[model samples]
Target chain A: MKRKQVLVRIFSLLVMLSMLAACTPAAAPTAAPAAEQPAAAEPFEIAVVVKITGIPWFNVVETGVDRAAKELGVNAYQTGPAQADPAQQVKIVEDLIAKGVDAIAVVPNDAKALEPAFQKAKEKGIIVITHESPDQVGTDYDFELIDNVKFGQHAWDQLVKHMGDTGEYAIFVGGLTVPLHNFWADTGIEYAKTKYPNLKLVTERIPCGEDQELARQKTLELIKAYPDLKGIVGFGSLGPIGAAQALKEKGLTDKIAVVGTVIPSQAAPYLKEGSMKEGLLWNPADAGYGMVWLAKYLLEGNKITDGMEIPGMGKATLDGTLVKLDLIMDINAENAESLGF
Target chain B: MKTLLRRHEAYVLLIIIVVSIIITAVNPSFFSLENLFDLLKSMSLMGVFAIGMLFVLISGGIDLSFTAIATVSGYAVALALLRYGDSLNIFVIFLLAGAIGILLGAFNAAIIYFFRIPSIITTIATSNVFYGILTVLSEGKWLYGFPTWFGDFANIRLFTLYSPAGNPYGLSIVTVIWLALVLLAWFILRYTVLGRSIYAMGGSPSSAERAGFNLLRLNLFVYAFIGLMAGFGSVIQALLVQTVAPNSLVGKEMDVIAAVVLGGASLAGGTGSIMGTVLGVALITLLGNGLTLMHVPSQWYDVVIGLVILVSVGVSAYRMRKNIQRRVITETA
Candidate 1:
C-alpha cells in the first residue's frame, strides 16, 4: 500500500511538471483575443498577483489585465490568494515562479514578506514588477499609478478647495505602521503647512482608517472636541467612508468636508449628499494594466528607460527600480459611476 | 463605603466618572449632549460582543471565535440580502445571521464536548478555521450597495435631537439593538435556572455536574447563546457602518475580551455582573474618546490604554485580596 501511494504521488508530480512547461514563457498565447495588429513575436506570459481576489478594487484590476492581454497580445492574466495575508501572498508568488511565467507583477500585501520570494523570482530570471510598493528588495521595478508626494499634496488640495485654506483639519491613516498611508499623511501635512499656512492640523495623525467603526468614532470625537474644525483628510480607502458617516450622523455633512483615498462607489452616496465634497484616488485598473504592460516591455529585452509610457497609466519616469506616474483621479458624485469598481 | 467598594460595578463607575471629569476638563465639548449621544452609539457594537464574552467568562470558558463567527455570518447575510432580499423584513435578516452564528458556535461546542478539551484551546483552533473558511469564501471582499429599502431600514432612529450647533444626534438603530440585547442577556443571566447552572459550572464543573445539571445540554446552551449574540452584533455592526468588510472583525476580540475581564469577571470564572460589564465598556470608550479629544499622540495612546487596563485590574485585584472576605477550602479527592 505504501509503495502504491508513493507511485501515485510521483505520477501527480510528473503531471504538474508537464503542465508548468506547457504554460512557461514563449510557449503559450494562441488563446489571446485577436489584436488589431498581430506582430510576429512569441507571446510572453505575465501574471499579476493582487492583494486578494474577488474584491471590488481588484475586480477592476482584473479587467485592466484582460484588456492589456487583448491589446498587447501577450499571455497575461491575474491571480492572488483569497485573503490579504503576507504568507498567502508569498505562496502564490512562489507558485507563479514554479510555473516559470516570463514575468510576475504584484501589489504586495506586505512588501517585506515578499522580499525572499521576489529574490527567488529574480534568480529565476523572471521580470518582476510591483505596484503600490517601492524600494522593495530584489525587484526589477516598482511602479505607482500616482506619484506618492503628489497624491498626498492633492489630498490637501481637495481639502483646501472646499474649506478655503481651512480652519482646522485632522488626518487619519489606516495605521501608524502602514508605510504608504503614513507617507501620504506626511506629504499632505507638509503641503498644507507651506501652501496653505492657515490650514491647521487639529492633531497629529490618528491611525484608524482600516476600521470603519474606529474611524467613525474618532471623527465624532474630533468634531465634538474641535468645533472649529473645517475639514478632515482620510488616508485610507475606508477612512473617507467612516468619516462621512460620522458627519452625516451629526448633521454636519454640509458643514465639514472629507477628502482622501476612497472607493468611488462607497463614497458616492456621501458625495451626492454633501457629506464629502471630493475623493482623490487612482484607478486600480490603471495600476493593473500599467504593471503588466511594463512587464511585457521588459520581457522583450528592453532596458528600463527614464521616460517610457506605460499603457493606460500615462508616462512613467524611472527612479532606480521605482517608477512613478503622474496619474490621479478625482471622483465626485457626478462621475463616480463611470470609473467602474 | 467599604460595602460599595466591594462591588465591582461601583468600582468601574467611579473610574468612569473620574475619566469623564478629566476629559471634560481638557475638552469642554466632552460634556456636550451631542458627543454623549455619539459615544452611546459607538459603544453599541462592542457592547454586544462584550456581553457574549461576559457570559463565556462567567461560565469559566473562553471563546476566541465570536469575532470570526460574527463576520462570516454578517457577511453572508449581507450578500444574501443583496441578492434576494427585496421584500424580506430586516428583523428576519438579523435572525438569519443569528441562526448562522449558532451553527458556527455549535461546532465549537461539539468539539469541546466530545473531546472534553479545554474551551480556550478549542475556540482558538476554531477561530482560525472559521476565519480561514470566511476568507476563502469571501476572498476578503467588502459587500456594499444595499437596496434602497435596506438603507432606509438602517436609518430608522428613536428620535433626532439637534445639538446647539444645529447638528442632529440621537439614538440610532445600532444603539437600540445593543440596548435590547443587554436587557435580554441580563434577564437570562439573572433569572433563569440555566443561568445559575452556568455560574455553578464556572465555579466548579465537577460540582455543577453533581448538582443535577445535564452537562452536555448545559454546554450546548451556553455556547449557543454566545453564538446568538455574536450573530446579532454582526448585523448591527454592518448596518451601522453601511458596508461589510469581511476581515475587519477578527482582530477585535482582544479589546472585547479586555472589556469583559476589566468588568471584574474572573478569568477562572464564577464572578461578574451586567452592570460591571456596562461600566467597564464605558470606561474603555471614554478613554479612547478622551485621548483623541485631548490630542494625545496616536503612538502613545495604546501605551496609555494598556497601562490603564493593567492598573485598574491590578487595583481591584489587590483591594479584593486585602479587603474582601474569603473562605479557602482545600481537600483531597
Candidate 2:
C-alpha cells in the first residue's frame, strides 16, 4: 500500500513537469476551436515565425496574434530564429509541420531560402503565408501581404508631395544585398527617374546594413556628398531612425526631410524633433491578428474562397495566390502623438 | 566514392563549377570577373578566421571564442574612434583590435590552464562573455562611420586588371593579405619545431607528455597564438566589410568548425592539413554562392550544407573503421 502511494506521487510529479515543459512562451495555436464549430471539430494550430525574438516589433505582433488566437478559440505558437537566420527559420517550420500545426506564417530573413520549407508545408496540406512586402518577396514564397513596388512608389509619391516633386533626394538602405530593401530602392529610383528626373541619387546607394550608427554615418555622408540634398528615403526601420539622428547631430533638421518604413513610436520622437518628416508602415499587429484568424478559419473546415469574411476584420480577398490586406499606416508629426507604443 | 573521399576539395570544386554553370545559365552577368572578384573579396574575411582556426585545430584545441573576441575588439576600436572623433588614425584602430584579441586569448588560456576546465567549455563561455562585452559596449546598437582612410583597404586593388572587354578582374588588397597569411602559416607549420610540437601534442597529448612535453604551457601558447591571429583577421574582416554589426559574426563558429572538418581535421584530436582547411573555407563560400545562384531555392542551401557535413563525417568514420579492421587483421596474421 505504501509503495502504491509512492508510485502515484511520482506519476503526479512527472505529469506536472511535463505540463510545465509544454507551457512555452509560444502559445499553441491549436487549442479550443470556436463553440460554433461542430462538437467533433478539433482546434487549429498555427506557428508564427518572425526574424528574431526579443524585439519590440515581434513582441507586439505576438501579443496581437495571441489575442486573436484566444478570441477565435484556436491555439497559436510564436517562435523564431535566435538571430535572423534563414536556416534556423527553415528548421522551425519543419518542426512545426512535423508537430502537425495547421499553418505556418513567416517573416523571411531571405525570400529565396524559405521556398522549400513553404513548399513542403504546402505538400503536407498546410497553409504557408508570408508577410513580406511585394518588392521583397522571393519567387519561392507563395505570396506576400503588401506589394513592395506599390509601397515604394507610394512612399516616393508622398515624399514628392511633401517636398513638391522637384528636389535632390537620397536613399538610406539597410544593406546593398537585402533583397527587400533593394527592391524598395529600385522602385524609388524608378519613380525618381519617371517623375522627378532632376533628383540626383547621392552616392548611388546608401547601404547601412541595418546598423543604426552606420545608417547615421551614411546619412552624414549623404549630407556631405549632396550639400543641397532636399529629401531622403530610408528603406528599412533602422535607416530612417539613424538618418534622423544624423540630421539631429548635424543640426540639419530643417534642411533635410526624411521618410521610410519604421515604427511610428520610433519615428515620433524624431518627428517631434522635426528631423524626420514622416514614416510609413503596414499594420503589422493586424497582420499578426489576421494570420491567427485565417489559421482558425481554415481549420474549422471553412474553405478559403476569394472573399472570406473574417469575424470582425470584414472581408479579406485573395488576388490569385496573394492575400491583399491594404493594411498600410502613415504617420506624421501631427498625428504621431496618438499612435500606441 | 573512394575517389571522391580522397579528393574532398574536388567534390567541393565540382559543386562550385556546377553552381557556376547553373548561375551563368540563369544570369550570365553573375559569371563575370567582377562578380568573382566580389566573391573573393567577401570570402577573404572568413578566410582569415579560418586560417587561424586551422592552427588551433591542428594543435588539438578549438577557439570558439575567436570571432566574438574579434567582434568585441573591433567594436572597441570603433567606439574609440567615435569617442575621439578624428584624432584616431586608421592604423591605431587595427593595433587596438589586435591588442584586445591577444588579451582575450590569454585570458581564455589562463582560465582553461588554471581551472582545468575543458578547452571547449572555456572557449564557449568566453564566446558568451566576449559577445556580452560587445553588447554592453554598444548597448545592443551598432558602431559605424569610420573615415574613408579606415576602409581604404576595401577599395585598393592590384593594378586595375580587367577582362578583355574591360571588366574589373584584379583581386582586392585584403585577399592578397589573406593569401600571404596562408603562405606564412604554411611555412611555419612546415619548418618550425614549435609547430611540429603542436601537431604531436594534438595527436596524442599523453604520449607527448611522456616524451617530456609541457602540456599546460603548450595549451596556453597554442590558444594565445590562435587569438593573436584571430585579432588580425577580425580587423581585416571589419575593414573589408567597412562596418561592424554587434551581432554580425554570431554563430560563425559553426562555419569555422565546418571549414576545419571539411579541410580533413579529425575532431578526435590531430590529423588535418592547412591546405585542406583553406579548401574547406573556399568550398563553403562557394557552396553558399552557388546554391543562391542556382535558384535551387533558399531552403535547400541548409539542406545542401547539412548533407555535405554529414557526408564528410561519414567518410571520415568509414575510413577510420576500415583502418581499424585492417590493423586487427594484420596483427592476427
Candidate 3:
C-alpha cells in the first residue's frame, strides 16, 4: 500500500507537469487558414464555456449557437463541466486561453473565480462574452449577453403584476452563493423597497440549493414560518414548482400567488393547476444563438459599432463588443402550455 | 441451510427487512416498487466502488485517491473531445480513460511499495495532488456532449431486472459492467494464491514476509487494482449519467467506505467479502431514498446516512464479538 501511494504521488506529479505543458502556448491555432477564406475575412475561434454539459437546458442553447455559427460559417465550440462548479469554470477559461480560442462566451459559475481568467483571456486578445448568468461580466468576462439588472427588474415587475401592487411576499431562490440568483433577489428587494413600499418581504430568504426536493422542503418550512405570506417569487427552475407544491399541499394555493423566472414547461402543471400564477424566462436557445452570432460577427472584422445587426440574429446593439438581447419572458398559464420542457 | 441463515449475510438481510418494514409504515412510498428499484440502482454504483475498496481494507490497505483518479478520468475524456476537436474518435476517449486509470493505479502501487508510506497518509496526499491537477486542467468547467453512445448504452434493458429511474431505470450497461468486475474481483479474492497471500499479509505483514511472500509486488498489485477500479468507477459514473461534474461525487469516498463497513467488512485487515459490500451498498441506498420520499429534508439525508453507518457497524462489531467469545469458550473447554 505504501508503495502504491508513492507511485501515485510521483505519477500524479508527472501528470500535473504534462497538464501545465498542454495548458498554454497551444491555446490558439498556430495558423487558422487565413487564406482559405476571402482576403477580407479574418478567421477566428470562439469558445462557449458553460457551467456544465450533457443536460437539455444548456445543450439546447448550444444547439441554437451552432445553428447561428453554421449559418454564419464561423468557427465556435461549446464546453463546460459535467456538474456545476465555479472553481472548475475558472480553470476552463485558462485552458481556453491556452487553446487560443479567439473569443470566449461563458455562463460564469462564479463571479470572482473567473475574474483572473477572463482578464487573461482579454489580455490574449480574446473577446469575452457572457450569457444568462453574467455574474463575472464587466470583470472576468468582457460583457454579459443578458441584462441581469433588467432581468431582476423584470422578475419584480412580473411578481407585482401577478400579486397586484400590495401584498406580503417571500422569495424562493437558488443557492445564496449563485451570483445571478443573489443579484435577482437583491434587485427584487430593492424594487419592493423603492417602488411598492407597502409590500412586505417575509423574514429571511429561502435558499433551495438548486434542488427541487430541498426547494419544496424550504417552501413548506416557509409556509409554516409565515402563513400570511401572500406571494412567492422563485428565482430558479425548481423553486417555483417546489413552492407551488408546498402551497397546494398546505391549501394556500389560491391565497398566495407564486411568480418568478422558471422554465415554462416545468412550471406548466403548477400554472394550469392554478398552483402558481405565472413564471418568466429568457429563451436560452435564442440567447445561445445570439452569442454565437455576436462572436462570428466580431471575428469577421465586421466592425464593433453600436446597433449593428448580425444575420440570423435580430438587430443587436453592441456596447463595445458586448451585445445585449432584449428580454423575452414566458408567462405560465397563459403561455406555458405550448412551451417545451 | 440453517448455518447459512445464521451467517452474517443472513443477519444483515433480516435487519434490512425488519428496519424497512418500520420505515415503510411511516412512509408507504418507501416500499413502492419504483422506489425500491431506484434505490437499488442508485446504490449499485456506490456498491461497486465499496466492493473494490473492500479488497483494500481486508488487506489492511486504503485508497483515498480513488475519488481523485475517477475525477481525472472523467475530466480527461470530456476535455479530450473538446480540445482535440474531431481529431480523436469517441471510442478512443474510453480507451484513453481506462489506460489513464491503469497508469494511475500502477503509480499508486509503485509509490506505496517503494516509499513505505502509510496507505492512508499516502493516498490522502495523492488524492489532493490528483484533484488539484484535475482542477487546474478543467478550470472548473464540466465536460458534456459525449457521443450518444454513452447514454444509449446505459439505457439498454436486460430482462425484468432493469428500470429507468435513477439506478432502477434500466439494466444500465455500466451497472452490468461493474457487477461483472465485482464478481471477478470476488473470485480473485477467494480462489487465487496471490489473493490468499494478500489476506495473509493483511493478517500479519511481518509473518507473511518471513514466510517468503513478496510483500512489495503484492502491495503494488493491490494498490494498482484499487486504482484501476477507481478509474473504472469514474467511467461508469460518467457513462451512467453521461456527464462528469468535477465535483460530481465530492466527498463521496465516505459513502463508499460506509457501505464497505456496513457490509460487515472489518477495518482491520483480512475480514471482508465482496458479497458483504453489496449488501452494505443496498442498505445505504435504501435508507437514503426511503428518507427522501418520507419528506425528510435533503440536507438531513447525509446525517441519516451517518447514523445508519454507525448503527450497522455497531451491530457487526457485536456479532463479531459474540463469535470470538464462542470460539474462545470452545477452545478453553
- For model 3, the docking class works out as incorrect
User: Tens digits of per-residue lDDT for model 2 on B216-287?
Assistant: 777777787677677777677566544556666655677787887777765545566667777777777766
Tell me model 1's lDDT, rounded to 2 decimals: 0.79
Model 2 CA lDDT for position A273: 72
Q: Show the colliding residue pairs in model 1.
A: none
Q: Give the candidate order by descending DockQ.
A: 1, 3, 2
Q: Flag regions of model 3 displaced more than 4 Å.
A: A1-341, B1-7, B26-33, B81-94, B159-169, B321-333
Consecutive 10-residue window with the lowest summed lDDT within model 2 chain A: A24-33
For model 3, residues B1-333, the per-residue Cα lDDT tens digits are: 124313767666776887688777866646555444445445656866786688788787777778878788878776775567466654576677767777887787777778987677677667767776666555445555565455455555463442222222334455567678888988998899988888888777889999999998888778777767776677667655454656555457877887886776655566677877888787877775555455454457668878877776777666666666777799999
- CAPRI accuracy category, model 2: incorrect
Task: Provide the global lDDT of candidate 2 against the true structure.
Answer: 0.67
Residue B263, model 1, lDDT: 85
**Model 1 chain A worst lDDT run, 10 consecutive residues:** A24-33
How many clashes in each structure?
0, 14, 44
Which candidate would rank higher by DockQ, 1 or 2? 1
Tens digit per residue, CA lDDT, model 2, A1-341: 22243345336434543542343222212222223434565667777887765445566677778798778767675777546656666777778878767788787777777778777777788877666634333222233345667788888887776666777887766655466777877888898798878777654556553555446645544553345778888876677877886666455677688888776765676787788888887666777787777666666666666766655556666665566555567888877767774
Candidate 1 DockQ vs. native: 0.25
Candidate 2 vs candidate 3, DockQ winner: 3
